[model samples]
Target: MVNILEFIIRSKALYTTWIYYKPNRLLFDVGEGISAALGNKIYSIEKLFITHSHVDHIAGLWGFINTRNNAMGSREKDLEIYYPKGSKNIEDYLNFIKKMNKYLRFKLYIKEVEHGDIIPLKNNRCLKIFKTRHTPGEKSIGFQIIEKRKRLKPEYRNFSGKEIKEIILENGKDEVLEEYEKKIITISGDSLPISPDIIEDSDTLVHECTFIKESDRKLRNHTSLDEIKKLLTYISPKRVILYHISSRYNRLINKAEKELTESFKNIEFHIVHPEEISII
Candidate 1:
C-alpha cells in the first residue's frame, strides 16, 4: 500500500506541520500560536522535525509536549524530536519543558541530526535532512521525505510475473532483483533566496515568501517574489506552496495569488493562511 502524506499549513511564520503515514506518523516544524493547537487534534505525532530554533518556528514546541502529556494513557509510544546540531540551547529548552511539566508520563527523546543524515521510518521509508542556507547563526536544516519503490530489473522487465517470482525464489534475499526509486518532498524554512538545487524536481516544494513586491527586495532573511521567480528557472516542482507571509500583507493575498498563477502556468502556487490545511 502507498503511504498517506499530508501537509497542514497553519498560521503565519514558516510554520508547516506534516503528517506522513505508511511508515510511522510524524509532524514537522510546529510554529507559534494556534498552529500547534490544530496539530494536537490531527494525530498522535510520534516524531517532530524542527528546521531551526527561531521563536516563530519553535514557540509551540512546549505546547505540543504538554498536549501529548495531557492525553492521559492514550499515547503508547515515545515522541522523538529531530533538530539540527549546534543550532541553539536545545538541552536548555528540553530541561525547561521538563521542569515545567513535572508530572508528564511519556518520554521525549531528543536527537540531534546532521547534514545528509537519514532518519529511518517504518515500511522502509526514510527522511533525509539536508543543510539549508537559512539561519546561518544556528545550524538550520531542511527535510526531504523519501519513499522507496521497487521495480523489475532491466533484465527482467519483459518477463512475466511467474518468471519474476521464480527468479526471486532461485536468488537469495540479498540478490538485487529490482531497481529502486525515490520520491522526495522538500521544505525550506525561512531563508533569503534559497538555491534552486535544494528543491530541484521535488514532488512538492514548500517555501517561505514573506514579501510579494520588488520594492521589498531590501528585506533581509526573507524571500521576495522576485527571488521566487528566479528559482523557477532551476526548480520545476509540481506544486509550489508559498507560506509565512507577514500579517501586514493579509489583504494582498488574493492579488499575489493571481499574479503568481498568471506567471507560472505549469506549477500550482498556493498561499497558505493561518489554520489553512493543504494536502500534497
Candidate 2:
C-alpha cells in the first residue's frame, strides 16, 4: 500500500495539527496535546512551521520542546522551526519558556520567515511562504510546496545525455534553463477571506470556515461560508478541505457538507473535524 502523504492530528476551530511527509516529515501548527498524540517521538518531526502565534496554534510548543529535551542524546538532528517575522509576542514567549526549561538538553533552532521566501525541503523541492490577511498581532501566512523540473530542450529532444554533454563541451554553451512546477498545498489558518494571490491555482486548499452562513455582524478575523465559496471560485483548487468550525456549529457539519457539495460539484469537498486525518 502507498504511504499516506498528509494527516491531521487535531482539526478543531481553536486548534489544529497537520502532518505532511514523503521523504521528510513536518508538523504544522503544534496545538495542545500534539506531543502526547505523537507518542513522545521526537525524530519524526524534521521541521515545524507555524502559521501564526495564536495560543491555540502554539500551545504545544512547550510540550514539544520538553519532549525533544528528554530525547536529546537519542535524536540525530536538531529541530528547526519557522514562523512569521516580527509577529506578536513570540520572542518574549519563547524566551520565557526557555528560561523555565533552562535545563533542557536539546537545541531548538527558530527561524523567522517572511512573505515570498522559499524554504528548501528534501529532494530539490521548496516550500514557498506567502502572507495572509489576519489579526495584526500574528502575521498569518500560507505555504506552497514547489518542485523544480528539468527536461530536454525542444531542439535537443533526440539528444542523449552523452551527446548533450559533448555538445556543451564543444560549443562552450548550453541551452538548458530551470523551470518550476508546483503541487501547491495551501493552508489559511484562522483568517478572514484570504487574498486571491495567496492561494492561486493551489492543488489543495485547507481553509477555515468558522461560520457556515453569511452574517451581518461586523466582520471579525474569521471566514464565512459565502466567503469560502468566493475563494473556491477564485482559486479553483483540486481539493478544498473546510476546517476550523466553531464549537457552536458542531451540529451543522452535515448541513454545511450538503450545501457545499451541492454548490461546488466540480471540487472535492471535505469537512474535516478534530482528530480526523487526510492524506493528500
Candidate 3:
C-alpha cells in the first residue's frame, strides 16, 4: 500500500492556501500561517512548489524561512523552492527574502520553471508542470505528481507465474516488462478552469472551488462549482478535493455539502471549509 499524508488548510478565499504532502516531504503553495499550522512538521519538508505569485498563495515564505533557520532541528537539509518562470511578483519576493534572511543555516535554492518542466524526486517520482489560467497577465500553473512504475506488458500478461519466471530468466525482465507513469496526485492552484487532460487519471485531484454559485463568480480568475461539475463529466478521479473556497458561502456550507454529496455520489468528494484543514 502507498503511504501518503496529505494535509490542506485554507482561510476563506482571500486568506491563505497551503498543502503539505508528508510522503514526499514537500509543500505546495506556502501561504500565510503555514509554519504555525504545521509546527515542527515543517522540518520534514525538503521542497516547495509555488503555483503562482498571489499573496494568498505565497505569504508564508517570510515566516517559513525564519522558522527553518532558527527552529530546533536538523538545519542541514536543503530546501528547494520552485515557481513559475515569468512571475515577477514571486521573483521580487524571493529576492526580498534573500536580503532579509541572510546567513542562513540550511541551504535554500529557488528555481523558476515553465510549462512541461519535469522535476525529479526521490524514489522514481517526479512533478510535472502545466500552464493554468489564474490572472489574465500573471503566470500561473498547476502540478501533477507522477510515479514511474514497471508493469508487465500485454503480451506477457497471459503467461502463468512459472512461465513468466522462465521467460524472465531467458529473455531478461526488461524485455517482458515496461516502465509506465502513474499519476499519483494533481493540484490545480487557484485556476479558473483546468483541462481534463491534466488530472483525468490521477488517483487524487485537488481543485479550487471558489464559488458555489455562478452568480457569486464575479472574478474571471476564480473557479466555481458549475465549472467543477463540467470538468467532472469528462474526467473521473479516485478522489476529488475542493479548496480555496470563498467565505461568503460559510452559512450555506452544510447545505452545499449535502447537495454536492448527493449529486456526486459515485465518487469521493472532500471540501476544505474556510479556516479548516482537510486530510486525505
Candidate 4:
C-alpha cells in the first residue's frame, strides 16, 4: 500500500517551507527556490496545499506555474493550489498570475478552503483542512492527508469473508460496514503550536519548529521548540519532521537535534536545516 511505503526525495525547505509527499505527488507549500531545488521533480506535483499566503511560504508560485507551462517534458496534469478562505494575499496573487500566464497549456486551479473542508485525492484519499493560530486574522490553516475506508462494524466483526458476502447479498454493504478515516500525513504549515487533537493518530507529522528557544521567537504566531516538547506529551505520531527553522539557529541545530533524539526515543525526529534541502 502507498501508505506503508516511504521514499525520501531531495526536496528543499527552510525560510521557504514546502514538503513533497512523493506517494501522492503533493506539494505542501511553494516557497522561493522550490522550483530550482526540486528542478524537474516539480513537474510531478499535481496538487499544492498552501497553509498561508506569507511571502516566504508562497513566493515561488509564479515560478512553478510558469515552469510547468513553458518547461520541456512537462506533464499536462491539472495543478490545484488550495489556500485558506478569505486569503486576500492569495486571492490577489492568483488574479495577477492568471492575467500574466494567459496561454497556459494545462489547467491551473486556485481554490479557497475553509476549516473542516475536505478535498478529494486519488484512491479514496483526501486532504482535510483545519484552522491554525498563526498570524492573527490571517486565516492560516493546516492540512492532513487522510484515507477513507469502510470496515466491518463491531457487530459484524466475527463474520468470515464468505459469511459477510452472504450477509451483503441479503442486506447491504452499508449495513455491515462502517466508515473510518486514517491519517496519512499531517502538515502544520507556518503556524503557532497546533492543538494535539488536530494531529492525533497521524502516521507522520511535518511541523514547524521555527525557533529553538522561546526568547528567540520575536513573533508570537510561530512555533518554538519548547511548545513542541509540550506537544509531545500528548500527541504521538509515528514520525515527526520539523521545518522552517530560523537561520540564526543554523549552527545550533545539530546539537539541538542530538539532545532531542536522546530525549524522544520512540518517535523519529528530523529537522529541515536552514537553507538546505531535507528529505524524510
Scored by TM-score, the top model is: 3
lDDT, residue 35, model 2: 70
**Pairs clashing in candidate 1?**
none
- Residues 194-227, candidate 3: write the lDDT tens digits: 8887787898888899998899777789899889
For residue 204, what is the lDDT in candidate 1? 77
Which candidate, 2 or 4, has the higher lDDT? 4
* Model 1 C-alpha lDDT per residue in residues 83-143, reported as the tens digit of each score: 8887666657877988998876677788999888998877667888888776447778778
Candidate scoring better on TM-score of 2 and 4: 4
The most accurate candidate by lDDT is: 3
lDDT tens readout by residue for model 4, 1-280: 4445343322233447667888888988788877877888888889988888888888889988988888875758789888899999899998999899989889888789999999989989998999998878788889989999888999999988999999999998898999999998888887888888888999888888888889977769888999998998998887888888888887988988888788888888888888567765
Give all candidate RMSDs, comma-separated: 3.8, 3.9, 1.8, 3.1
Better of 2 and 3 by lDDT: 3
Query: Which segments of model 4 are wrong by more than 4 Å?
Result: 1-14, 150-152, 156-177
Q: Can you give the lDDT of residue 176 in candidate 3?
A: 90
* Residue-level lDDT for 67 in candidate 1: 72
